[model samples]
Structures are given as structure tokens and as C-alpha cells.
Target: MKFSLFITGSPTSTKACHSALDFALALMRGGDHSLAGVFFYEDATYIANQFAMPPRDECHIGQEWADFATQYEIPLYVCIAAAIRRGIVNDSEAKRYELDTSNLAKPYQLEGLGTLISLSSESDRIVRFR
Candidate 1:
């Protein structure tokens, strides 16, 4: 089995991101399937930016996502259109979009809808986390 993920809510606003990470990690443990892709759109795009850090006593949701993706080598991606509009862009994309370079550390890719569609075609099922 294969799964495609779509997260629409911000990580800090909901536990959807953490729950999805747990699900994906469990899937990896089974080793019977692959993560086709992870798509974050709408306000969820903020999860890809490291700057979403909350003050002390708050959970580091974005860091949790980055760590999970890095450890599992999952291709965590955010909607390019959504990210750009929300002021999140990499050095390369920033230049392309004529915007300032933003803080997108690693393990996250700013990709287009085509990536999601491709995953949809390749995966056995499309599972939306939130």
C-alpha cells in the first residue's frame, strides 16, 4: 500500500500534523508501503517555515515536522503558490518569484500541484491528515 498526504490546517492550530507524522512513521515501520508525498496547503504552508516558532512553553510543531521528514527521508512538500503568497520561499524560489529569501531550512520542498497529482496517480490511496 501507498499513501498520499494532504494537510490543510496549520500545525500549531491543530494536532493533525503530529497525528499524520505518527501514521507515516508507523507505515514506515511496516515497510510494506511507501509515502508517495506529503502536501501542505492553505495555512498549513506555514508549517514548512521554521519561523513559526512559538514562545517557550509552546510545542515546536514545525520542528517536529522537519525532524520527522529528515529522519524518514520523506518528501515533505508545500504548495508553491500557497507558500509564496504566504511569504515563504527558498533562495532559488525567492529569486524566481522576485521575493526576499525566506527561512525554509531543509527537508521541505516548495513544489507545485503536479507533485500532488503525480502522487495521487502512483499511490493506492490518498489520505488527508487534516
Candidate 2:
């Protein structure tokens, strides 16, 4: 199954992010389904943060997703509007533009919602982890 994981919550103190992450992992491990990639949108798009670090004891779900995405080689995309609105830009983006580079995690590209639309067109199942 060509699936796209759409996350719609902030990375910090956001239930949608956590649930989306969990759901993506489950789909990755599912015996009968195939996952294509993960897409972040709205406030949940903030989950694409690479520099997100909390207390040591606390679970770093964002990093977990980074590692998972790297391991699986799945494409993780963030909405450009959302990322900008939330102030999460990467080095490249920061250079091209001026913004914080905390949210553009590796394996995740900052793109427009049109990308998601294309993904939805190609995806067999578009699951919303909100």
C-alpha cells in the first residue's frame, strides 16, 4: 500500500504529533500494508523538527521519527506555509530565507501543500493521524 502519513499538530505538547508518529510506525510494521511516506501539515507540521530536544528522561518522539524515517528511507515532507508560520526552517532554507532552523529535520523537506496533493494522488491510502 502506498500510504502517506499526514500529521496535523505541533511537535511540542501536541497529541496529534505523537499519535501520527505512532500511526506511521504501526503502518511501517503492518504485515499487509505498505507505507510510502509521511506528510506534515497545519500545526502538526511542526513535528518535522530536527533540533527538538526535551528533558533527557523524556521521550524524544521527534528524534525517534527522524531515526525511523532515516532507517526506512521514507520521505518526510512539511508544509512550507506551516513551517514558516511556526518558525521552523533548515540551514538551506535559512540561507535562502531568514528563519529559525529548528524545525526542518533531516529526511524531511519543506515543501508546499501541492506536494501533499500530488502525494495524495499517488497514494493508495491517505491516512490522517490527527
Candidate 3:
């Protein structure tokens, strides 16, 4: 089965992000299931912010997500509007917005709701974490 994940929680304030990661890991370990993609929306868009720095003792959820996506070749999609509202932007977005720097983390792409729609349509199921 193919699954798509829709995450809408703040990585710093909620366990939803971590829970979603755990779920994804478990799904991959099953070997029978595959992930079509991961969509980070609402507060979850913060996970794509490259400038976010957690305490040294804390887990860097963004980095964790990045590593997972890179290893599994899973696409990480962040809502462009939500991400921009949270000050997360890639080089192109920054250039377009005339920002001095871009803070969008690697392995995460900024996309619109259309991307989510497409992912959902292509997946057998969509698991939401909020």
C-alpha cells in the first residue's frame, strides 16, 4: 500500500511531528507499505525552517525529517503559503520576496495545496497527524 502523510502540528510545541516520524519509520520497516510523500501544513510548516535551532540536548526534528526523506527518497512538501507566513523560504522564494536570506531546510519543497491534492489522489491512503 502507498501512503501519504499530512502533518499539521508545531514541532516545538507538540508531539504530532515526532509521532508522524515514528509512524513513517514503522510503515517503512513493514516493507509492504510505501510512502508517496509527506505534506507539512499549518504549524508544521515550521519543520521546514532551516534557521530553527533547538537546544543542544533536544532533538532536531527538522534534521531528523530531512535525514529520513533523504534516506527513503520520500518527497517532503511544505505548504508555500503556510511556510511563507512562518518565514520559511527557499532561495527562489527569497529572491522573489527580496529577502536577505532563505531559511528553508534541505529536502523540503515549497508547494501549494495542488501538490497535496495530487499526492492524495495518487496514494492509497492519507494519514494525518495533527
Q: Which portions of model 3 miss their true places by more than 4 Å?
A: none
Residue pairs with backbone atoms closer than 3 Å in model 2 (clashes): 8-44, 9-43, 9-44
Give the best candidate by lDDT: 3
lDDT for every model? 0.83, 0.78, 0.96
Best by TM-score: 3
Candidate 2, superposed: residue stretches over 4 Å from native: 98-103
* Order of models, best TM-score first: 3, 1, 2
Better of 2 and 3 by lDDT: 3
Backbone clashes in candidate 1 total 0
TM-score of each: 0.88, 0.86, 0.98
Error of 2 at 3 (Å): 1.6
Ranking by lDDT: 3, 1, 2
**Tens digit per residue, CA lDDT, model 3, 1-130:** 9999999999989988999999999999999999999999999999998888999898999999999999999999999999999899999999999999999989999999999999999999999999
Compared with the true structure, model 1 gives a TM-score of 0.88
